[model samples]
Target: MASWQQIEDDNPTFAAKVRSLFDAGTNKTIATLRRDGSPRISGTELKFEAGEITFGSMSGSMKLLDIRRDPRVAIHSPTLEPPADHPEQWPGDAKLAGTAIEMPRPEGDPHEGAGYFRVDVSEVSVTYVGNPADHLVIESWDARHGYRRRTRK
Candidate 1:
């Protein structure tokens, strides 16, 4: 896996995809490495800020314990809309591969009971649902004009 810095630097387009996914209100399912090196998967909120994604827990749950033991995590977000032009290639699934670390609770965070998880993505990829094409393209969006093609597989 590339270092977090390297992934962002080498894959700006991929990063943008991650950002778009967050903006679309996608719920990211996080897989954290357990203490015994087992995998623990849990749903996480996807919060988009500036140019990155941030996640926080609402219950300070067991998932937080798993995070403290291991930082590696994989996140998945199912597509909200099917790809218009390439139905086969983008039947619509998106995945984020990365390392996650718990961010310290802010002094006055409103969600004080909520735990925080921050991922430094290594790779962002997509796949279609039961299609001959093997990959999906991602688009970038903002308030002004909405989504535009950001990258191809």
Candidate 2:
């Protein structure tokens, strides 16, 4: 089987799924680990482009601080169902697991440390929604499919 990056590269539709959630959406609930080995959760608007995901953060944000101590994290994307008039049913839920890295931010970019965390996905899954293979369900207008940016040719 091909790798996630390879599959996403070969299929525009799959790539669109990852992009739709990162863009347009106001927040992504990111789960990370605290120093005490407890779970920590936070939400942030993220930017996904060029096969990379990025988000802003402050110097002392718990999420940022947690990432500093431990990089592994789980991310959840709230699936948006389309309206009834549409032809396809939107996905009910989805998730991705990966590592987070702090990118150096330029000076004066709001919070410190570039105010962003980048996640490199190692695994992705969709559950509770009808099998995605049925393109008809996804194509429906009533189903609120996750948002996607216009792809460049």
Candidate 3:
């Protein structure tokens, strides 16, 4: 897995675009695996700081318990529908998948009881509609593959 900083260093432009998508909204979606291996989706707020992506769950939250038991996770940036008159104006959507690393909370911190996890990104991707014929464009980065681009009609 690669850290967010590594992706940024390797592909600055693509990383910037993905970051912008995350910044465009305050709430994102996170997926986690339950004990029985069922999928669970939860609303979350993402923080990109100190070259890392992090999020915290409220004390004793199910999502917190889920992450503690299974770190594998996927987070999707907030989705925004294109304007009726300007479909091409959509900023795009982004996703990140990785294992979450629990971060230690400082003593007496305001949210010390909450659970925090730092993302160790295995994959990152963004999709958008291109100009002209509006071909679908997909750009992705992975620790093993580095970077890739694809387009479809």
The CA lDDT of each predicted structure is 0.61, 0.59, 0.91
RMSD of 2: 8.8
Better of 1 and 2 by TM-score: 2
Q: Model 3 compared with the native: what TM-score? A: 0.95
Considering every candidate listed, which one attains the maximal TM-score?
3
Model 2, position 121: C-alpha lDDT score: 63
Ranking by TM-score: 3, 2, 1
Q: What is the lDDT of residue 86 in candidate 3?
A: 73
Off by over 4 Å in 1: 1-14, 79-86, 89-91, 129-153
How do the residues 21-118 of candidate 1 rate in per-residue lDDT, one tens digit apiece?
54565566778777788788888777655445567766557777776667667777744766666667443556766666677788877775667766
The best candidate by lDDT is: 3
Candidate 3's C-alpha runs over 4 A off are none
Q: Judge candidate 2 at residue 99 and give its lDDT.
A: 78
Model 1 deviation from the true structure expressed as Cα RMSD, one decimal place: 7.5
Q: What count of clashes does model 1 give?
A: 0
* Estimated TM-score for each candidate: 0.63, 0.67, 0.95
* lDDT for 127 (candidate 3): 92
Candidate 2 wrongly placed segments (more than 4 Å): 1-7, 22-24, 79-88, 107-110, 131-153
Comparing 2 with 3 on TM-score, the higher-scoring candidate is: 3
lDDT order of candidates, top first: 3, 1, 2
